[model samples]
Target chain A: MKIDTEKLLMIPGPTMVPAEVLNAMALPIIGHRTGEFGELLVDTTEKMKKVFQTKNDTFIITGSGTAAMDMAILNVIDKGDKVLNIVNGNFGDRFAKITLAYKGESIKLENEWGDMAEPEAVKEILDKHDDIKAVTIVHNETSTGARNPIKDIGEIVKDYDALYIVDTVSSLGGDYVDVDKFNIDICVTGSQKCLAAPPGLSAITVSEKAWEVIEKTEKKSLYLDLEEYKKKYNEKKQTPYTPAVSLIYALNVALDLVLEEGLENRFKRHEKLAKATTAGLEAMGIELFAKERARSVTVTSAYLPKGVKDKEFRGLLSKKYNVVIAGGQAHLTGKIFRIGHMGTAKEIHILATLGAIEMALKELGVKVENGVEVAEEILMG
Target chain B: MKIDTEKLLMIPGPTMVPAEVLNAMALPIIGHRTGEFGELLVDTTEKMKKVFQTKNDTFIITGSGTAAMDMAILNVIDKGDKVLNIVNGNFGDRFAKITLAYKGESIKLENEWGDMAEPEAVKEILDKHDDIKAVTIVHNETSTGARNPIKDIGEIVKDYDALYIVDTVSSLGGDYVDVDKFNIDICVTGSQKCLAAPPGLSAITVSEKAWEVIEKTEKKSLYLDLEEYKKKYNEKKQTPYTPAVSLIYALNVALDLVLEEGLENRFKRHEKLAKATTAGLEAMGIELFAKERARSVTVTSAYLPKGVKDKEFRGLLSKKYNVVIAGGQAHLTGKIFRIGHMGTAKEIHILATLGAIEMALKELGVKVENGVEVAEEILMG
Candidate 1:
């Protein structure tokens, strides 16, 4: 009954969970008390700060990345408060929707699907909204292959006393974002993505300023009560809610793996792999949707060739190549598809994914050049 | 680096996750959009219905039992909505606090710790408040070891137009809770307690009547939004947001194990275990904290001797015999300890826990009979 994962999971989240990490999760569930539980929490939190590259308090929620987004927005942005949401792709829109649901006056600054949220537009919107209390944006958009200029955007929100809430869902361990240096009041990451754990928990951090906002704000939330947790976190290394204990165990292992690899090395590897992935796709005459702001790693969104269907290519990849890739969302459906190379990925994985694409293209009668050749040319380091 | 857990998890939740269920969780992460994902959702939902004993629409959330309680309240009860919350233990107070946070006018029906919410008290309260929209109660109070009579409480709320919401956190699989026959509108349960899965996601069912109230209510929520999930569940068997995929896999396996044991036999076994546990404890001259209402098989609170401290006894039990038990909360702290025998329990575990308790008492120099002989007599039956 013990099933070993045969396929290396390369999906965006729910990424490859190492055997050691899985076994760590299978540790007998202990009471959320005991010195053992406290020691685990303290160690996990301190290690989390190492990855987040911030001294600010890190609180892990027994939920998903979206839940973290909800926590960040619901707590920081008070109802009827002016806020600016920069939407570039799916995740950005989700943040905007979340901000709107919190009764925040959401002023949207949007861009084309492939484009990044422009710095000029954000600055302009901020200049106009004198009452704006917070401005939210995603560091990495999982839908489109784009990494926004979060550091630049974080700087923009600095002077205005507005809280900078960053959704670094797919970018956390792949690249570094020092929340303290960047003046980010709120930063969030998921366990399943670059952290390379199973999908269950979302790791979050809030600044002193952000905590102040949360304290005064009215929340209809009982689950993501940040202050409640912060209170408990201050006293005992415990969450206000019953946390996903096993997932926390898995996350600790994943964090250890990331640290062992070293952050700079991991980021550089992602950069190299991303370039190779883009090179491989272009070799097949397929243009990626997000050409201008193409992210270094984690995910890639590429255009489909004429008469080539995305669903067919994905199916063929799954059935024949034993690979899985994401198709385009609404309005871009059948036009583009996304491939991910997050935690536990390397040069070899991108090469295989492109190799599958090559086979799929040939079977679908699309004229294509060899992919691995181009991939090697870009990734050979 | 791989740590194998042979130590049985005898706690109320994160119960002994069988190896097969662990294997199921370790299955390769699938694309949430692919047919593979759809198949998992559809299959899980059907099995869930069978387990819940309800034909109502049920959805899973990546949260603890507390989150389920919050979602249940937030969805149906709005600002100024009158709610009657039965508070007898920690979890019951959780319901009250959550209701109050939502700006819901809740009547707190105070029941003694280690006592169930009285039916006559509920009837009297209901007679006074025609504005009451919902009546909330916990099925099993792990904090006090009391199982509320949902059958009688449901009948109390049945005559009124108000919906009945129940927290079956520790008793869903261990005991029979007929969601349909009991006239329960909303029921929430956690995976770890009796379901024998790790703690991460919580499952809840909403009846058609509850849906009507939720539909009419205008509330602002994002991550815990039940309405958003309802729209997606019917079409895609997908959550509006990404889910804790692997935990769902674990639940799938855990459900198989529970259904295999069958409800009737499972409940009978739990009842027998409860009887034996009480008889054995009494034979050793220890008094039960919840004798007013029979202790639930899932969890039960027991008082220590007047001279011996609960924490000191707990220390002896853990250090000597490796047995873990729940301690008292708030006012009850150091006065009582709780033992769980919910999931994956056999005749031996109960005796082992009792044997440990006996040894701890004797070591603490407390007056006590032979723990092993009394426990053995009850267990042999």
Candidate 2:
């Protein structure tokens, strides 16, 4: 199957990588055990720390973001340890499920699908369960397109002695995350999301406090061992196993682009795109699924129009307009559609995506007009 | 630490990828959930079955060969299941470690590092432990360059009720292994080795009986679950998690190359290179590490000259001659070196590699001569 290479990809993760990063990946692959790859690994780790906004040691593991999330849970918490899991969406609930899978006791504080994780609810739970060993939360819920109040949650957790672990799989480079200031013990981000590289590598940062806990626990898994990574990074700046070398090369180029654009400007770009896309959808008489304050900057989620079918509308956009967007996951499927604006997308691309949606809506007999103009107005301002 | 990109990669895994395969990987990234990617995944799976010599389900997982090795064990064998692990070298030992990590009871059948797993030895162990749930072995041990008699071992294993799983990580596409005829229940291979793709993906073929065992077992992992892959493949031909899309594209092209060359011809090519390499090393008065009958066709292992240091000799080849070979791993480190002649390397490349070693040995005052001539004589015949 030949890919439509010219299509504008607007998925939530695996967002469009720039030509420069793609070119970097096309370069010849070096041996992973060689000094050349070791140097690249070290340089990528240093740059990843800048992107993660932490002074902690950063390591890249050869798997998806879920691997990093699993490692974070399996390494720190032993069986039967009490973990306060904040669940607002699919990813948040996944943390709770992973805790259960590893035989940990999870005290779940679940909110509605589109609701942001509230600090007061978390504080109330922590007040009741003082034996909580770790507080697990998703900073940005990918399934519902809601940005939880992790800074406030982090502040509340610091009052207690629970280790704060955050999954920023959909945020990191596109959104602002101060890992050190937020008192986060473990932070996880994926390569395909805001990093704008290909999928397969996950970057993680571990604070000193988390390492102490990890040092005391036996390894639950040989594949996702944190101590193995720590030993390899400290001694040789190499991974314990063979890594995805070409993906690392792409990530190095992607991180350089992130630094070149400056973090604040990149965050502003994501915010602007989110606002423009949301305004365009609202002008078409559609309501956003996420609450106003909790709307994610990387992707904008909205309810489908009364007459439009989710699959048909998405098919028309992809086949005819060459604009591929993401559908809702889990329970939100067919109820909502997501417009991703993370990494490498600009004002013009956002306008084009809105125009394609408008055309698809017209074809589906939904009364909508001037969507591109609405988006352009917000983007220009 | 920029790589000498022009150098020939002669390592066991991550061998030289053909230009066509490299170009396929350079293609633009596509969404994992897209129909385009689904078609590619389906096509690749079908072609992988042909290469694996199996009629069972083949899965493309987004990790190293070790992930496939890990999955083969984690999926079928539950905790406390008795497994007879045949230990010939490092990878064979790793399979036992994985079994123990997952709380399984393992009975090890030991052999020396550079020796093959004898069929008689395996039969003896199985007779003693008739209650063994599974038998794990490696077709080709990458570290020791020893190819075990898996076909013979498989004949002995068919008498028992134990499931037979084999790791063909370094030998799948380049060597001969009839998965069905050998009674192999599960076989694991990597894209980077004899398949001639970049390192990131592992393909595994599972028989119907193995799937029955997997269906009855509870999920031990979310990532490496074979049932999850089977469910996704049957329903929509999609991976349950985000995959390395670019690597899969490369694998598709590499498999096409393998089929075009014909399986028998590819196996003959590997055998020819192995013979030529062995003839060249012997002419230089170097002894092969592995026994004569057990030497691997993909990589040739030889003891380093008495007066020459492994590092200095390998460094001279890489730095001056632009030919990168592999040093010994684990217990054999500094004692032996390896030369790989797997996928995409031709007879001329083998002669060139032998010439590089000859020049390097002369620089190290080893007095080795006519290495390239000896290799050419064998290749011509």
Candidate 3:
């Protein structure tokens, strides 16, 4: 069957953007130093704080989520500083890599890819290393569809001297992240995930405690320097460098959509979507990848049916049904597939994606049935 | 008179983007890992090579131009490495700052803001600093509207053992940048400038010699690391991190527009536009800021007429005429104003901008005459 050329993006990030947000991005470009852009920057930063559930000073960086994650670490962890990294999935491991790259001593608390970081393990590590300057964890591990217990880790770290840093790149709007309430010192998120905006822009909220460390740390990066950003924002309500102006416009509108839907409502919708996706996949005889308690609310990971090739299945789904999904990364490649239902994804997208997966599996000689029906049951309920 | 709320950006960067390029950016977001996006990435990179007029390996980065500049310096200069930075304007000084931030000793070859870097001075400095690992210069200083003689400096630097790094952030697409011919080991440019694409993405070209230096340099930045980007691109035609997907789409189209117009034709157009802008300003009794030999072909810097206030004049232009221009940066603030005539700017924009400036100057009681007519004569001729 021939499908429309526009393929639905069900990958973890660069999620489907809304027309309103896209239109906002399509608006005429504006100078970053202008008062008009300053107003936009201030408005977007304020709205972003609400989504983060924090009153901490937030900065919009013109790079990927990793840039924000890098900034979060590089600003606080000076050379030879000890940092505790909780690694459960790909992005979690990335923090450790970034820490090591900057010559910081990284002590990682490890977990299986499909499992969440244990709060007890993080506490034990922190207890062992009194010199640890920060504890870093990924709120949602998009690679394995696992959601870590960031709040629990935050609680344990707050009592210690180590600053609490969390990468909420794929989970900020889709999941509840009470940064201030959880005593998070630094929280980072990207625009392309649950914000339903274009990629390339990331935001980080910094508490006063983080600033204390940042101010004392030696300058390591000119572009990712948070002190310069804070100074510029304080003086003119602008970024130190020219920002991704169009993406800023898009993010402003995306924030409007998120606030209009309400944070709780958005989280509920993501939960419902995750439930539908998992239910549909399980009903189709596909095994869920992540542990039940660690399942992510934005993306769902499941094993391919026996005898179904990963590339063939995904290609067939994309070419024949115009549905796009993600394959596993690193060691899990070709063993699992991930479906993202975050941001602008709706009940219809879930049904269509499930139907596409079932069709592909059946065509590949795997016994599968009632996937869309099961998804509909959960979504409608 | 009341004017439309839509602003016409005449800033040196975040230049005006065409509607077509903006519409391309509005397209549905695609997963970066998809074959479709890979194809787009390859196409854009290939076309970018053409615009750069080089056969060197180029990578698209997900941050502003400063990120690329930072990447260029940090990737090559290790701690205590000596780098010669030719400072003629703000961006030139920025290169020195990035070097100093990374703990590299910066030797400055200082030129006045409105003057070009002297080739003999660069050679003399290189002769003195035989241990210098690199020499950095800005091809076009956006802050001062001065175009340095990159080819001349490139010729001098090629004889030295040091790598030649050039920041062409505001010049690449609108000016002639023969990276290979100029022997630039590393060149950086931003998307929002002459590319006429939305701000946020920057591209860097690394020569084989530059890669050798980069490979041996200690890791300082994880996000701006060039090695990871090269590895990812060589393994699969993709960025190491998730790219600004929408901006990439927009850039693909912008490159198409650029190539369609032809490089020589585009350069000619830009030169003509620059001529018209300067003529218009001069006719309005404004003094050009940059020296004759150093005048940039992308942005024009001019001193405000007697009794003309920078903020008040720009405010009148923006509020009454819906035209926007930039004020001087750093120490030059409130003393001069800059007019950008790059990217999608044409004769009509130049005329309109000139007329608005004339009206503003007249409102401030400065005598001005035939500015628009003079600009039209240059453009139409």
Candidate 4:
């Protein structure tokens, strides 16, 4: 409702939020301890359970996606516990780092960026390490635009004694993720990513198994302790601390849109968009950075065209066309750029992004052709 | 702009936000890594320095007031260090608890809930315990509606080797606190408080002295680590993690309003309103909970009328009059109620709140007279 319609936001997370969701967030401040706020929070949690596709207890944290990951790890694992971290990208490695921060021993099952973690590899590690307390994995790796095989790995983890933790920060709403079916003990996602809400809130669902682990572990950080969160939520349907009330309102509205569209349909729409985006970039003679079968539906990663500098190309899109996209992170920086197509994004948005890229590349004297047409063809099909 | 203005929000922290701030938040989110967002963040930090009254590095975090306090402690103290905690209310005690959670020893100088922490007492403790690494104090205690003597304590702490950490969650924008003059090493506040912005974001100012300690301490949390925050901020003027962009945008606008009004005028306005509220309640034959000189300008804590039921009185105000007020917490529940008049709250709003309370009390068979008239008279002056 208050958005500047001129500039289009296409970042992976902090994706383009719908006007309806923005309007919901724009609603006035409510007392966090009031019955009205409690009722609102309870209702929103119920809706979030449906989005998460889980019967487990869901709680909201007033922080970024990384904070959710911290909660999932810090609550379940105690100091000196051995945790298996499956790393394919930046966020996965962050899981190991967080575990280490909590004094847990992180045994990382490493994979290359833009590659998926194999179920067999995870099975081998779990079989070898019977004392592992928990296993952390990223469902969708935004850093390299890769989607890990969470369901396959979840099936393997279900048979093990270790608690299964999944980070679905970039995929939850846009991709197919049934938390219960995936045998997830703790599933984490952020409001800014596929939920089409602003950043600063993370939605996390916890299973009974995770709670058992949490009960045994000492509270690590006061603000992030999940036991405190659960107790406060169960008693009064309120968070242990003050939450981002406006963002919660926005998330509820965004979840309404997701449910209205239907989860399966939303997943299919994202899949189609991902396909179109990949096909268009390929048609433009640009190579996608992600390996086949591991690419993400929410974001598409690709190498920059020859002669087109990363900054110059991105600047052209932002400054000239009023379209903004993200560049690569960490080791991939300057070599690639990523275009996000999640949460309120449509075929037109995808086509427009490609068209702008095509024009920008031409201005830079890079040889590229029919990017928009190729994207439109794929989207139509 | 989307608020149900009929139901006034008169609560400490998550205070009523202005229409302009809300509208600014509702605007479309931009990429966090974009030049535009970086410029916005830099400009906001500059404006925030004016509010904080310091040349220190101020970083915005995505969490409540407690998280900022957690950051202040976790980043400065290592394991097995001694810290002095000044406890007057719930939040002050929480600082000690956090210090203990990090394995630091906390020596508490306790005060009654409604009483203020004495600077001389702190100096005595410092005199006794020269090994104390840091001293944590609360500028405004929301639970008891009391304001501590931060400037006085700051003067004492400046002579010592300990870091002076102040929690200004409920007082920052409404009260006078010069961080530089007060020798505050780490000063923290939340967006939902007197800033008149939404929750889920905290603005914390870290002095060079505090940073020196943080540099030596091992990282406690990946999410709340100020050292990581400073590095990323210094490199690109961006947070290490994705921030609540909408809330930041809203905070920038809210800070604009605060600066436009002038800090001195804002503090005077809060003082006058606080006096009016207290006078009006006393005129209605209700007693104020906070001590005379230590009363908070943002919130007023008061004893319920003899025959009035806490739930029944509050229920009538919400259901019948469409107004909301807060009841006391922990041991003070059912004994007192709190009325918040911070951020975007005007004299007319205070008059309306008192009028509603007067009407509710009358319905409950409590004889009350001239409550609104008294408030109006004080406000008129």
Question: For candidate 4, what is the DockQ-based docking class?
Answer: medium
| Stretches of model 3 off by over 4 angstroms after superposition | A1-5, B1-5
**In candidate 4, what are the lDDT values of residues B28-135, reduced to their tens digit?**
888888767888888888988999999999998889988999898988888889999999888999999899888899999999999899888999999998799999
In terms of DockQ, which candidate is strongest? 4
What is the per-residue lDDT of model 2 for residues B82-158, given as tens digits with 9 covering 90 to 100? 99998878889999988987788989998987888789988888998878988999999888889999999999998
* Model 1: how far residue A211 lies from native, Å: 1.3
Report the TM-score measured on chain A for model 2: 0.98
- Superposed Cα deviation of residue A158, candidate 3 (Å): 0.7
TM-score (all chains, Cα) for each model: 0.97, 0.98, 0.98, 0.98
lDDT of 4 by residue, A1-381 (tens): 123458878778789888888877778888888777888898889988999999999998899988989888888877789999999888999999999888899999999899899999999999898999999999989999999999999999999889999999999899999999999999999999888888889989999988888899876789998888889998988998999989988988888899999999999999999999999999999999999989999999999877678999999998899889989888888988998899889998998899888898989998887877878888988
In model 4, state the lDDT of residue A3.
32
lDDT of all the models against the reference?
A: 0.82, 0.87, 0.91, 0.89
TM-score for chain B of each model, two decimals:
0.96, 0.98, 0.98, 0.98
Candidate 1 C-alpha lDDT tens digits along B304-346? 7879987788877776688777788778999988788887777
Error of 2 at B110 (Å): 1.3
Model 1 global lDDT (CA atoms, 0 to 1): 0.82
Colliding pairs, model 1: none
lDDT, candidate 1, A261-299, per-residue tens? 999999888888888888888878888788555454778
